[model samples]
Target: MPAQQKKIIFCIAGVLSFACALGTAAAIGTQLWVKGTILCKTGALLVNATGQELEKFIGKIQYGLLYGERVRQCGLGGRPFQFSFFPDLLKIIPASIHVSVILFCTVLIIFALVGAGFFMFNAFGSPYETLHGPVGLYLWNFIACSCGCLIMILFSSEVKIHHLSEKIANFKEGSFIFKTHSEQFANSFWIILVCSLVQFLNTLLIRFAGFEFPFSKSKDSGTVTGAADLMY
Candidate 1:
């Protein structure tokens, strides 16, 4: 490819990487990761409650890694509550897994930013005989892609296999009881997946920008002259 076209491709990849990084960061901090309705099982099973009373035992909940909002309808209208996942609720929850998810998210964000910077640098600046060259593009993008994949895998495992939603719903305080009805990974979770895909595409773009695959070499096209050439 010509230098001008290569520059355009690199610029496109850089912009894409930067957008993915920003999106992943925003999803990490926002409260739209998981959205669901939780049913107050205790309230529903109350001796005084009838079939028509079940509506009062349902609540809506939405949360992300950092914080969440809940509105309970446990027979006394709707009571709203907000929570943080840090020191306050970490004590009550499975700390290790949740902490790991947060850590992976942070890693993904950092690597993504680094990859985007490399892409932009390679696009606009003269990068030669340095890590910021073609090899660096591959390295940083691969790292960012790995980080993004890990974040999604760990979080999905936490939510699905480990029953994170159930754990959160079952939190208790004195006479208050919480229960889960339904839950699903929301937009923010899917956004991380998109970020991962975009990073992978960026790697493909880098490859298409005239960089040879690492460790690959062209086969010798000339016939071997053997010892005759040495004698000459």
Candidate 2:
């Protein structure tokens, strides 16, 4: 490819990777990861409560990796809580897996930024060695792609297969109770998936920039002989 075309491809890839990184970071920090309703199961079965009374027992739950909001209709109104994977809900959910999801998300963002930097550097600045060259582009992008995919897969498993929302809704301590009526992965979760796809697409952009895939051997033609060697 021409030098101009290569520069254009790198610029496009850099922009895409940067956007993906920003979206993933926003998704991680927002409380819109999961949205659902929690029903006060205890209140629902109150002996003297009527249908209208039961209607007052439902509340909303919205949570993210670091914090969450819970609204209780029984009397508590809305409350926010911050929690970690180790000691809070680890018993109900796989702490190791959940923590891994967050870890990989962090890795994805870091690698994405690094990849974007390399892409821009190669596009405008002269690059010759491993870190500043095409090899670095492939390395960073590949790592970012892997991290993004892992984040989506691990988080999806926690939400869909493991019933994370239900577990949180039903969690209780002493006389306090939390019950879930319905749960779902929200916009932030979907946005992470989109970011993962975008990272994957960046790998294709890297390939299109005339850099050969790592570990593949290129075909070599026969070596040319000098006139003196031929005469000898």
Q: In model 2, which runs have C-alpha deviations exceeding 4 angstroms?
A: 47-54, 74-93, 173-178, 216-232
Best by TM-score: 1
Q: Please provide, for model 2 over 1-232, each residue's C-alpha lDDT reduced to its tens digit, 9 standing for 90 to 100.
A: 8999999999998999899889889988887888888777666565445667666777788888766767666544545444544477778787878889889989988988988998899899987666677667878987887887788788889877887776776666445465667888889888877877777787788778777666563444124444322220
Q: Whole-model Cα lDDT per candidate?
A: 0.79, 0.76
Candidate 2: pairs in clash: none
Model 1: pairs clashing at backbone N, Cα or C within 3 Å: none
TM-scores vs. true structure, each candidate = 0.86, 0.79
The Cα error of candidate 1 at residue 70, in Å, is 1.1
The true-versus-predicted C-alpha distance at residue 155 of model 1, in Å, is: 1.0
